[model samples]
Target chain A: MGSGLLVETYVFVLAVFVGFQLISKVPSVLHTPLMSATNAIHGIVLVAALTLAASVRTPGGIWVAAGAVFLATLNVVGGFVVTDRILGMFRSTKRSE
Target chain B: MNTVIQLLYLLTAVFFMLGVMRLRSPATARSGNQLAALGMAIALAATLWANHRFAGGALIALAALLGLVVGSAAALKVRMTAMPQMVALFNGMGGGAAALVAAGDWVARGPGGAAGAIAALFTVLVGSVSFSGSLIAFLKLQEWIQGRPIVYPGQKAVSLLLLLVDLAAGVALAAGNLGQGPTPMGLYSLLALLLGIQVVLPIGGADMPVVISLLNAMTGLAAAASGFLLQNQVLIIAGALVGASGTILTQQMSRAMNRPLSNILFGAFGQLRTEGGQAVEGTVQSATVEDVATLLAYARRVIIVPGYGLAVARAQQEVRQLMDKLLQRNVDVRFAIHPVAGRMPGHMNVLLAEADVPYDRLYEMEVINPEFAQTDVALVIGANDVTNPAARTQPSSPLYGMPILNVDQAAHIVVLKRSMNPGFAGVDNPLYLNPKTQMLFGDAKASLTQLLKALDEV
Candidate 1:
């Protein structure tokens, strides 16, 4: 692998580790907020995956990059959908007398 | 190529941190969401830029457009009321995607890479289970399926057997034995499916908040497993965050319900009607809207405590209306929202917000619980279990230690309910017998409407 590619890979992996570590320290009460934030990170990962896939020449590299893109996209979109749905359970309505 | 990608990664991390920081308050949550979305868009664009494969840019652009259209439509179309189901569906999708990835990886590897094979196996099992389990939970919440527990003889043993089979399949897959591999994998998935079904089937409507928390945790575990399979640190980290948060929330919820986690998991507490259950021995006092209206109109202070019953009846708007009327009369009105008032966390808050109730008027269980003592009247609408005095007074009761609204401390308590049926925890509320408490038996919405009408007259 080229030095540039190697450096990018390290940064990506390091970012993931650091992000998780920092988020792990978040208090339990702040989960919804933390989740909302991490969800954005997942989006970034998705974009990065696509970019890596595009630039990589090797077949294996292309496949892995594509896979990363899919997984990361799923994480971001899925998180929001789930969070919104969970929030909906609390909507109160008037009862029939 | 790498410099650009690295810059994108750095930007993504910054946005992620910003979003996480913004989540500390509800006021900034929307902004946080937008920031995260922006970060994700940047990341996607960067990835597309990096790709050198066949028309990678076109495919990325196409995917982005498709995603934007579909996502925007869902965001615009889905009402806040249907959010929980949406969350479940999305969680299922995440799990499903992870499982598919594992499957694809396995197929690509030709079943020879032992480590990859094991990781794939774990990911698929966890992901599939979470996917199916979350779907069932969504169904239960949506009332697409019954929320009541479905139990027959030997149900626990059956669940145990299913779990055992799942474990056995994991062992076989890890051992690189494909001879009977597919069978066990299929069986493991089936058992996980049943586990989801059986686990949720017995829980009552009241337990949905906890169920959501539990399911959220499951989804996290699934994601983390998928991360391991893909050797992706970020996935693992994100998944762990979700899993741990969900677990903690579940514990807090369980505590709020005054039940041990074991009882919640294995006791099937809400499923069966206790045998020899007799009608609660109490002198039930009844009231009319006129009487309630009179009391509220003259009262120096009134506290409203809402519960799942309120949500079920969709009485939040009427409740808000009632509050407005009471406020106009110079009655000091405030809401006493229990921590576990609705099916999920912040359920009551969300419901009240929809009614355009001011954020200031709403008080958490801890804040309002103490104020109930000095309050002249505690108006409980369609709330049963959370306000039950049994949680505080009855040691033998299932909800004995659970924190309640303390509505019983008020000089006068008004409870509106459809019937005297026991709550989800299957315990009778002794608060109904309190001389100061009066039962207004009817649909909560209708009762509130009548009360509002009577208030107008008063």
Candidate 2:
């Protein structure tokens, strides 16, 4: 559980490598969904958004933080749902028309 | 309890990685998306529990609920034709959220230290830029704004000046303390958003895939910067992962068009031909629907080239019907899918799939290219730029060196188009005028229906 700037950098770099290995193999047909899925993953920014909302004391800060939470959640929820819908359309040769 | 929260975060990151790995195959992609959603649920729960003591709990819940409802409803309702801008809008929102979070940190905690200040500034800058840039991309794709590149006087110079000022503000805020000026962060954030608009304004609608991908990467990096400011491992990991994904897609989309990312953003592609098609030296032979139907009905093999115009006219169903008819006539038929055929990467595949076109018959540019030479007739529907022979033959043309479909190699070429107007890139197609080419000009849907009727009579 120990943390520091260096540890955070390590996590970032390693996660990037993992992302490359995982996403590069996605064929062109699945690109939109993949982009969308990754977009949903980053909607984890809602973490920071929620924390910021909790920390704010003034009205202006609360409003800004609320906007943050809303947008992040929209990104998270919309991104995943749409990706699923798009993937629903993709049928291989085995599937009937 | 702190240790437990950190472990939950770790678990969420693991789920994310596993989910992305599963996305490599279409069969597993749906579950993969659901898995990532599960991870998001875990993260949300953990965040709620960790911040249990904080005020504004009701506000947070309300905002999140509204987001959930709105996002899901919009996602459920948006047509497949509008997917690119929908994704672009969501990307913008994420970026906006990141910027707001960073701004919140700066306003509340006053930067905390030099490193924190820098991270917060970066988050604010990149995130805001991504937000505005993506919104403009949305407007362009949606055609709320003109699809052509909108260049103004001193565009680059103004953007450079804005950057210099933003840099000055960022330095002052980082080197000194927050509240040092009458809104240093505000100035920096505003300038960043404007810079995004300035950068994206010159790029035409045809380059939307690259712009959207680039903005996606920017949003991810902005989230990571917020992670540094807040010291959150989950933010760092997930943000980095998406940053990498977006970067890979951006590069691949650029490669498909044979252009560098720099050229895409900076090249004023449609500016010169905004009035209409730049007349090339060739006599275009206009054909009746009967002539095309006769050509197609007699052909032994036919390859279809579709583009954004096909999507615009909602002719995917008509195209599928045409394919079936041609197959019944013992004509071998396949679709040539350019990587950038529609508004986004793999856009045509999704459209075709939605129309229930069998997957085996849809071929990518590289695989289907050589077949064009032997094809008896190439049926081009609402596609222009991709099938342009000038892209191969004219060096002075702006679209020179861009990889294009070799429809010119086919024994006979028949195009269904609305007018002689240029495509999204605003470049005239010489393919319309080639000696063997026959153009059937009308709205794509109406033209396809007429052609189908004529197929029986011819």
Candidate 3:
């Protein structure tokens, strides 16, 4: 709710919009790699949520922060775990008839 | 404290931009991934430093360690052939996470926090639905579930009623009407479960790619809603990008199949067939490996077209070997790849790549379609629907107006299929009856190996 926080939020929003615009122009061939990298950003969110939960003083802010941290952590870890399991389905071994 | 976090946010944004830029080519994709990863790390570190949360350090570390082990195993073990399934599962996880975030917020704050409560409820609803829908898609693609559409009496009525109930719940939650009563979390979760089942139940095999794209878009929207609840600008922007792109991809896929989006959702074209309805009338010609090998050995130019059948049979290596043998005989061999080939986009290319097929030899549908006329032999390895000429010539066919490989234009066509069954679109192919086309019925790998031996005799 502070002015400094407002400015930070604005700058962050602008940067993200710019980032989206840049990626929109990328061709299809590069999508996989791009996605893999963006996926890691979930980790950053997890850390931020945890830190905020521990330090923030507002009533119930800790719970909010904790919940955010948990979700972000799940996004980061669960994404890759599921991806690997799905990938295993494609392994084709020769079946003798 | 704010200044440092702000700087970290800006840095994360820049890395995201650079990552997107690097995605323009496969050659730089790895570097792009690294850049995004670095950006995420910076943002996380800065946020943590600003808040200085240390109570759960040990727990977080343990979780991180487990993640690293599981992630590495998946990355190292997953085959390229199953990339779509992998994508679906990841999308589901992302959506599930977003939904859980919303659910957690709602349960903790109750209805007094109206704005947060509503946002959380909406995200949970959408995210959960997307998550379950995507999981079904994964099963369908993996063949763990039937590829054919499932329909029962009054299915449409049930789906419509479910949608109505889901909407009503959303409206009630948004109005902040449950302050003194028990939360409708149970109802909302049930609606989400039904929505998932309803959406995926009617989708047939041929429409899996389109369904995947649509679910992907839903997940993105759910993420954006969760971001709104958290008031995170970066999450909103990224989520919006994904949602928009996914929607566009779904549209394109629908257009490519020459079907309207509504047709895909409600018509359920491939789910059932009229009893005893026979395929379109056409002459059937059969061939042996020696016959196919003789044609290939004597031909100066050959074009190989692959489909889902090839992937199902795991025949990429044999096909590659056949190409190698043809190359030894000084034959000109090129692969004709359809844009919507196999079960998903780029499916054939990935399978072929695993077999170490030369990249230069693979040609997209647009580029190679015209050359089919000049080709001496169009060797279709386990492909059916995409190569069907009926799409181009038949106006009433379900697949009419769709783009297809011009293999029928070639001098001679050899089609390898397991049976005379129709493709996923549930339409008989006239190409199968063409005079120039010869059907070599069997498993793709087995047929290719047989043909290889017969070629040796020739």
Candidate 4:
């Protein structure tokens, strides 16, 4: 069990390094969208919500997990959709105002 | 079969990583977001398939579908000025979800053991903090709550005491594994939530972007702790990626503004520095829209500096109209955008781009600073503190050492402001008092409309 945590720690550390390197290179012009994208990415917690939903037996636990699923879905859906909408406006074409 | 599902999850994680890398440029960013969405679908499918036999299937599906519709509508309908609040709202939901997941895990499984207890408790504490903190941030950004730094006597002391108590409660609940009526778990979560509100309350004004980014990072870390509780590889990876990236980006934003990360967070810049008493000796010159139009009409080159006011007044389109007329008159026109010009980095860019302001015409501070000297007219619109020359010279000024757009260097300066009221930082600007600077007062949009009509007559 301890070894499992150690392995997860290894993965966590390496992922931090990867994220730092990748995001540091993105220009400040896109930092707003970059924040939105990362916000969407962490919505991966939806997986936890789904897994908990299946196993939770208590009525209270099920209700709690249901709420988690709802919020997680919102984070995933709203985050990516808003980010796409913003980035869509960044066209290079010179349109007359 | 389980191993296969884990492998698929890992593969999808690669998609997420690739998606983030694609954000390096605007050209590929839309496709990049699509790829990440694809990854999310795969991950969700893998989990749904894996957990098919688990209970509460009908309820989960209902919640997910309901969330999908509401989330989409909100995203599609929110106006650009409200973008910061929208992001804050979504971020708060993520943090709240992680905390609830952790809380449910503890209640359902009785912490599973020591390792589980630690992970679950950690997620519960941090996630709740991020949840409540982001909500307060949302209210402040939405202007539902006052944007001023809400401080009470001994605010710092209260925050410190609460934090210490929170940690102690977390330790006791974990070590003792106190399984009883109401549970210390609820107390822990409650304290953490209060701690979240305390954390964000004293932060106000131009410091919001950094706060939002930091809260984003906090939520990411909370999500990561939930990953540890669930033993989920993808959650671990994605959460860590967001946590780390959000942190680095926060520091970079502070650096871009030439301020320390700590100062940005704790300095409470607007509250600490009221407008300084030693005022400049020069008289304030007020000009009319006609005077500005004549100045612009005769100018060879003009640089326009935009600020939060432009965003507040929704004047980007009118500003765009002005720019088109200037170009039609054979007067060169460009926009000078300070990095922290709006509530968030790139806010002004998005607003201008929405109004069809060409990206090529928007010059960042570094590129546009030198050109101001050669320009015949510098049009300052709703921008105040960023143009304050004190940042460059005055040692006692709160804005001192923060990089500013050098609109003062232009041969002629016309400022469009509501009044002589100082900018958000409460630091009086010497630039407005300069002999060459003339303030043209009123709402930014109204003045722009008048200026446009005056330009036609000129």
Q: Which candidate achieves the best lDDT against the true structure?
A: 2
Q: Alpha-carbon error at B59 in model 2, in Å?
A: 1.9
Order the candidate numbers by lDDT, best to worst.
2, 4, 3, 1
The C-alpha TM-scores of every prediction are 0.82, 0.95, 0.85, 0.96
DockQ winner between 3 and 4, please give it: 4
Better of 1 and 2 by lDDT: 2
Q: lDDT of all the models against the reference?
A: 0.64, 0.87, 0.68, 0.87
lDDT of 3 by residue, A3-72 (tens): 5445534644564466456656654323333343344343343543454455444444444444455545
Judged by DockQ cut-offs, the docking class of candidate 1 is incorrect
Error of 2 at B378 (Å): 1.3
Worst 10 residues of 1 chain B by lDDT: B103-112
After TM-score superposition, what is the CA distance of residue B212 in candidate 3 from its true location, in Å?
Answer: 1.3
Q: Name the docking class for model 2.
A: medium
Off by over 4 Å in 4: A93-97, B180-182, B272-277
What are the per-residue Cα lDDT tens digits for candidate 4 across B28-86? 88888889999999999999888887577788889999889999999999988788888
- DockQ per candidate, 2 decimals: 0.16, 0.79, 0.18, 0.78
Looking at model 4, the pairs that clash are none
For B249-335, candidate 3 gives per-residue lDDT tens digits of 677678777789888888777865664224577689999888899999999999999988888899989998999899999999999
Which tens-of-lDDT digit does each residue in B1-458 have in candidate 1?
Answer: 77767577457547756765565555555566567666656655665555446435445445545554555466446555555565555555456556655544454443435555665676677667766776787787788887776667898888678778777866776675645323545565666667666666656666766776676666666655555555544445545555655666677778777777767766766664675233357698999889999999999999988877887888888998898899889999998877677666666666676677765677877788889999999988867878877767667666667888889899999988899787776767888988899889999999999999998898
| Cα lDDT tens digits for candidate 2, B265-380 | 87776675645434688899999988888888999999999889988999889998899889889999999988888888778877888888876788888999999999999989
Better of 1 and 4 by DockQ: 4
**Model 2 alpha-carbon drift over 4 Å, by segment:** A1-3, B177-182, B274-280
